[model samples]
Target chain A: MIPASFDYIAVKTVPEAVAELAKHGDESKLLAGGHSLIPLMKLRLSTPSFVVDIGRVKDLNYIRRTDGHIAFGALTTHHDIEFSDLVKEQLPLLASAASQIGDPQVRNRGTMGGAAAHADPSGDYPTCLLTLDAEFDVVGPNGRRVIKASDFFVGTFTSALQPDEVLTEIRVPAPPAGTRGTYLKFSRRSQDWAIVAVAAQATVKDRKFQEIRIGLTSMGGTPLRASAVEAALRGKSADADTIRKAAEKAAEGTDPPQDLNGSPDYRRHLATVLTRRALEQLTAGR
Target chain B: MRHRVAMTINGTQYEHEVEPRTLLVYYIREQAGLTGTHIGCDTSSCGACTVEMDGHSVKSCTVFAVQADGAQITTIEGLAVGSQLHPLQQAFWDEHGLQCGYCTPGMIMAAKQLLERNPKPTEQEIRLGIEGNLCRCTGYQNIVKAIETAARTMAAQAGKEVKAPAAVS
Candidate 1:
């Protein structure tokens, strides 16, 4: 399988990439890791006249600690996040989800910014980012702007990013002290996308839920927060019974797509079960 | 439009004028004359096209030739020194790791990365390490044993213990 012929533009810096995007507009597509866009191009699902290869922009491939958040360069590969000590210590949920995406070969090339920009409903990073309330730093012809996670994902396979904008960095606010998090993905196969997954990060104090945030994957057109579940569990006992009761509301407002992998009802059931397991893992031994 | 791409493959540098859409696997096989990297699934699901791109295993079928402009790639052909086989090749042969031998090159390449990161991996680790590479033959029993055998051989060659090398950036 080969993609349609297109002129390739290699950019060495973020300014150069932004300039190319401004020049080509919608006719061009920024190629970061090439893991997402290339596959679509091969299938003829996407045929861009120009491919702006940002892989040469080596500076946009870092993981750094900022003022109140950890900033990740848009080109930071999944493999780098999976193994980064800072990510493991600061945001273990992102690290855990990155480790389970596709496979080792895929992880080596897939980037967090690319995945978030692709905005697949089943993508691991979206759900984790939603739970973390990560902010995206985008550079465009008009200059730089930050988009909150809630506003970034518009729909399945869509994001709020304009065609002339490039996602430069992802800023994830550091979790509160003593906060523990876990990502539970239920897939038919190891490398397959999640059928239904859950991301939970919580802080428990005195055997009570201090703060908890839950995100569900493959439960809607876009990655969604399990608001009903979170509302039910806030300030509640961190016990198995309370978790089970709260988990029942996991799919309260979600409209999951029904496919061969599972029916909507089946997905709702999975959401409930996986939410319970994820919260239990987060609040274990509390 | 055609683009000029140059890279080091198996210790030899080759330059070619390839289309922007040409996959790295096709460039390696047709341009570089190295057919060891197989293409089982072109959609990047199968790791049969796996190759070492700058010291990391990547699906060659999914990587565009233009993306590997200045990379140092190591394919299955680059494994051995002279006529002697790499430890992984010898172990696979001894353990009967392959039946049809179609996925052998890719399996060995993927395992090369596995052992590079973790010299002594448990059986479960080996299975998870090669999760991207698929093998419909041998039931994966002997394949696990082959990786185990290769780890021990490489460890003994590097004195009593093998130290993980720094990853190439």
Candidate 2:
């Protein structure tokens, strides 16, 4: 109820949405799902003169296969992704992550692109995207640009998206054959945000770790890679001791913030515990 | 500014001009005059304002009237047919699913959605389905039992009656 008076324009096409965003610039906000934006607007935390609703753009709500990746449209609801056969088959990690997002209602109305673009530090999708090395396909008045997942997130409630750009698609590479991935989240309740979450992916070859990627959420200003752990994991034997020692380094270089749910120390502890759990789950071979 | 919205509620179609910021809960209670969908927490935490919007249960207080402009909505009042209560409503009444009756409607609506998706959910699944809905009075024990009983009744009505545990005769 605290939302101020704003122009409401529901566009039918992606180009129409992009053009409207181009015209309005900083004064307008593109609304898809509105799970994140509307709540902020209701709190009077953000005020936009125009709200260009892109939720009705059906073309931007699809899951298709691309060259080596799954092309997910920006407006694809979390519910859709959670129940998508293609996503489940191609990227079960994403499907599992999607299933654990908020609750049923929030999942029904929240969008993957919206969460990724919003880049909230504690959101679940950013961690998964970071581990998957996802690419965001953004469209603006100029054209389209594919931004790497690591570069897409800048800071709290911020992204690399330009002011006039609309995130059109999210392309997540299907994990390589024999690669395993898992997302581990710790929260007090089903609906609460993750206090700490970890997305760990690795490929094993000849009983040694061939490649490894680790993504952490709610541990820093942005979804971050466990670079120290990733470095320590390479060339190590796929054994419990090695993985545990590597995961212990998961909290390294992460200046986790303290909040009511947990202190920085607790979150750091959670990162270590969850990273170990995630790595153990992944090495268990799906 | 007020915009005209057309929607179907409980099998009746109505059109009205409403303020853009008017929440669906307000439009339902004030304009359509259906007060069964109670607004407990306007911040989208408590599902006491839960209603079926286009076949999906959503917290009405969190949704704008304009967002549901052309949708179909079903409230607690719509759950009964003539003089017969919905099986879930009857089960809740029979199983003591209410203490003050404030959270009953939302709990029933959310349980309906769960049963629709999964007709025979386990107790754990039922708990997960209604996690967004909070009921401080019932301690959640009787509420879960009521939902379980309703699911059985609904299944029986659908000709999928589950056999009760057999005695060691």
What total of clashing residue pairs does each candidate reach?
Answer: 0, 0
Model 1, C-alpha of A57: deviation from truth (Å): 0.4
TM-score for each predicted model, relative to the true structure? 0.98, 0.94
Q: Write the per-residue lDDT of candidate 2 for residues B9-128, one digit (tens) a residue.
A: 999997999866677899999999998888887777778988998888888877778888889999999999999999999999899988988888899999988888777889999998
Cα lDDT tens digits for candidate 1, A184-222: 999988889999999998989999998999999999999
Which has the greatest DockQ?
Answer: 1
- List candidate 2 stretches off by more than 4 Å: B161-169
Clash-forming residue pairs, model 2: none
Deviation in Å, model 1, residue B40 alpha carbon? 0.4
- Give per-residue CA lDDT, model 1, range B43-67, as digits (tens): 9887889999998999999899999
**DockQ scores of the candidates:** 0.70, 0.27
Query: Which ranges in model 1 have alpha carbons more than 4 Å from their true place?
Result: B165-169
**For model 2, what TM-score does chain A reach?**
0.96
* Candidate 1 chain B lowest-lDDT run of ten: B160-169
